[model samples]
Target: MNPLLRLLVLALVLPAAACSTLSAQQRDRAIAIAAAARAPAVDCGQPDRCAEPSPLRALAGEAFAASAAAPDGAPHHYALLLDEGGDALLARVNLIRSATRRIDLQTYIFDTDDSARLVLDELLAAARRGVRVRLLIDQLSAIADLQILAALSGAHQNLELRIYNPTFNLAKPNYLHYAASVVCCFRRFNQRMHNKLLVVDEAVGIAGGRNYQDDYYDWDAQFKFRDRDVLVAGPEVRTMERNFAAYWDDRRSVPVERLNDVARRLLADGVPAMPPARPAHPRRVEALSQAASDPETVRTQLVARAMPVAAVEYLADLPDKHHGDSALEDGVGAAGLAGLLAGAQEEVLLQTPYLVLSDHALEIFRGLRGREAPPQVRVSTNSLAATDNPIVYALTYKYKRRHVRELGFDLFEYKPFPADPPVDPALGGWWPGQAPADAPDPEVARSELPGGSLGGSRGSAGEAQVAAKLRTETRPSLLRTSAPANRPLPVTGAGPRMGLHAKSMVIDRRIAVVGTHNFDPRSETYNTEAAVVIDDPAFARALAASIEGDIAPGNSWVVAPRAKPPVLSGLNYSVGKVLERSPILDLWPWRYATNYEFQPGPECPRPLPRRDPEFHRCYAPVGDFPEVSLGPKSILTRMLTAFGAGLVPIL
Candidate 1:
């Protein structure tokens, strides 16, 4: 290591000596303080458990009972795709409410916002009613608010919470502590528990990309995630239980009382008595609560949507995903998706928010493309304007050529917001069963937003006119920004924006995969993740349809090769390829491909392939980054495209 770097590391690690780990005396005192706030046990008649009698719980019971007689390895499981955000949240709510014996939820981030608080309230209620509730959150992003972690320290005797892989054994690390942690224990700090799951009563569960935050469930007014999740019952739930237990019992999964920040809060303030939470949107909460409890509504929205499958295999990475001894295949989530794709006989439909691909992932695609009869590869990912992580989007931008020219990928970058922006600001309620009712028709309601045509995805001439309107509203100049990866170019609209966060795939339209694995290097090598792989053509088709909807011209932008410059097109291609192939920098101004809008007309009723002779005639080039300004983000993207390959493994 460099001498200055070594000295800096030493300086960072030294101050952590006084970190708030509990000594013997302090430990006892902390225990005493927390004991006072311990949840009162509710003794229900049945074996210290209060299992609910509801249609949701019954679905699991019936699934397990029916699965008992299935083949040893191929057991029956029912799966439901939660493409809509409201239904996704409603699923979690009903599953928790219906949980009889135990509820285990594992997530990457558990924010203290309304969405999280409402779910937290539910888990607390479940604990109070005598249902064992255990929540395990990744330490880095888990409960950043120290007070909430402190209160949760003694929230309930039945409700247990653990922070996974805490740096300096602290629940909420300060900026100083975080810097030192990255310097002193880089591997541990980088490898997080990216798993998102909710297993109830060891009978049913939800596994997918949603973290406990408003954005994931379309509740955030500023932004939302078009995320996906799979609700599974029967044999798959057993796998979820075991996977969660592995993380729960792992050494790195530290208890609340063991954390330094949480411990200090417990010692200084005693265990905090949690006040009754008042939801940010009471009507929204009430709507979901009523729908979750209503058997008819739950049945119609969830149970009816479920399709029985021959096999629903649950795959998850080991708790120590980045351990030195772990093999690449130890990432169960990655391996499952790989195996499914390897057998894609017809087409492969993949959707993920972060589109950066690891070398291993690129190699997989390469292998598929090398086949004599390669299947169609369709990818739906966030565009520059729609993405939450501008950094990751830059990486995706860096490799657009390889994805389109080499891999033959039908790349569809999701629009900022779609016609049906998951929450449906149209109806009275937002839940899949209950929706927002205060809106006029979608056309009128959408037009009221800053960039009303933003979600139209229609690729119409009117869209260009709206873009002109948006340009007038936005600041002409880019804001002065200095951050390398955090800088964001201004998107056209300022109103509520939506991004795609769903990580999913449909293979041969025969299998459906909905999981938290983004297939990036982090998911492939660093963080642990989990997913459900269901083998049912019906389910696969249903999943494909949902993804297809997201990629519709009105919902997304087609990424394709820009028509070769009329003159010296050949020379431009050669030079561009050389710059692209350069190991260090990809500075060629002209890119191989750009976003295209499908111009609908009497002559062109449907989409056309880029190879079609009349492709450019029907599809208009929309520049490299549409609805996005020329700014620091674009400059950084070019810089990273040249120098960011090394950052891929860690990022």
Candidate 2:
């Protein structure tokens, strides 16, 4: 054999040989770390305290809407909505540079994009600063980006990385699905660590929908998927700190040291040794000072914010109890949240990106509407026109008309953001107010009553409608004067303004819940999920108002329904009504895809092509969605199966 071939053979054989040899080493290392990181077992009796809080709560609150304030009256000041890629990256880098104590990160995907590299650079810097850095990522999601992980491993002794639920087949000619992964979907390769969180020094935290990816931060020129995240600094963050520790110490979360030489080499080459943190605003510290001041002042101003919930005594999902369970919760939180919605006496405003409600959810939504009828229940999500996930839209769209007519659940899809929103020229950036997290509200709202004005509502539509409505609206001059007539059309109506990626719902301004779960099938059935449901009336009202205000005409859009909604035939209307009533599809309609603009062109006047017709390549590659359908074959189904199977992970 050629020397290179000989080397390849050795490399192939080495993993298994090393695994056997390193078995004890890996176990000992994991055990040593686990032992040191063990959390104290404490009884949860006080409503405000728990035996332990997950480190994730730093970014996400221990209790929904819980204030970040600590007892010393030092307002727990944290930044939220770092929409700019540069700004977000700077925040993490600053935290790393500033850290004096510890660094903890947990993510579903800590990829190797510039953002991820930037984060890695910071993590290495923190480690060099003598900050203890612990990284926990899902075993499966990280496999594709193994080089980054390897890079981190090669250089940082102070840093300990763990892969949650690592696949056993890593080295062998193996074929067996880990039970956990199978239930959670392919991201898990069946299981997942779907949490997005970062806690530094147990003081500052970042959490929300944005993953550690380039697209997440608007670094890519291609269409950036709008998402949301919250930064926190408060006593509640300790809860998240604890969660990170818990997962970090879990025995099943294998130490990255266990990875084979090949994987390890890949990582080592992929990541360079730590670099010192560069200043976030090395030149412009003054601006950060101002942004930081706002959050700090706001926290202090809201003095009466509720304290943490009293601790409840319980085991933290003991493996023996509900071990390997498929559901996120046993239903207590779900039931409580539903009760909050059901108790709604008036209006209900929801902005969920993925709305796949189960029968139980539908019943809860229906009950809130007074069973088949009510004052009004409005929901804003991506139209097929706006949704990224067309299949999910297909599943959910089945219920649109029924929810509208029966429950009076009026549905509106986001229009695109306008070419211009009031820009902060000082920031040298267009705020674009609220763009779509795949859900853009119109620039203006039509009358609260449906057919109020085509003339009146031209600019009323938001970023979402701007793309499609420009061709149709009557006041071409107004739009032309205000923006190019070719600018995307604004949505019409008194309909609620939309948002990009806020999975929140407010019931008569009484309660709300926001978290990882979207209002769609992928969230409900496919992935492991978590959320915080807030019962505070004030918070709910504020949240609802904030959502509404963002999409409001001056900031967003409120458009009227089509003067003549493409009138459905009595038969189609009846079918829509029937489909809408179906529990499974009704709660999470899929029709939104019908509206997704498949073609990308200059803003235009007509509906986009139904299919790509030519399957235009995805302009922005989201690293390939992993293909899962590899096994089994019938001659006829083989090719079709292969093609379809390839898309399973992305879906």
Which 10 successive residues of model 2 have the least lDDT summed? 621-630
Query: TM-scores across all candidates?
Result: 0.89, 0.58
State each model's CA lDDT, in order: 0.74, 0.44
Tens digits of per-residue lDDT for model 1 on 98-181? Answer: 777799999998887667888999898888888989999988788777777778879878888998988888877766777677
Clashes of each: 14, 90
Measured with C-alpha atoms, the lDDT of residue 28 in candidate 2 is: 50
How many angstroms is residue 579 displaced in model 1 relative to the true structure, after the best TM-score fit? 2.7
Residue 155's lDDT in candidate 1 = 84
lDDT tens per residue, model 2, 323-392:
2543445443223445556667777787765555666667776676664446457676654323344344
TM-score of 2: 0.58
Q: Pick the candidate with the highest TM-score.
A: 1
Q: 517 in model 1: Cα distance from truth in Å?
A: 1.4
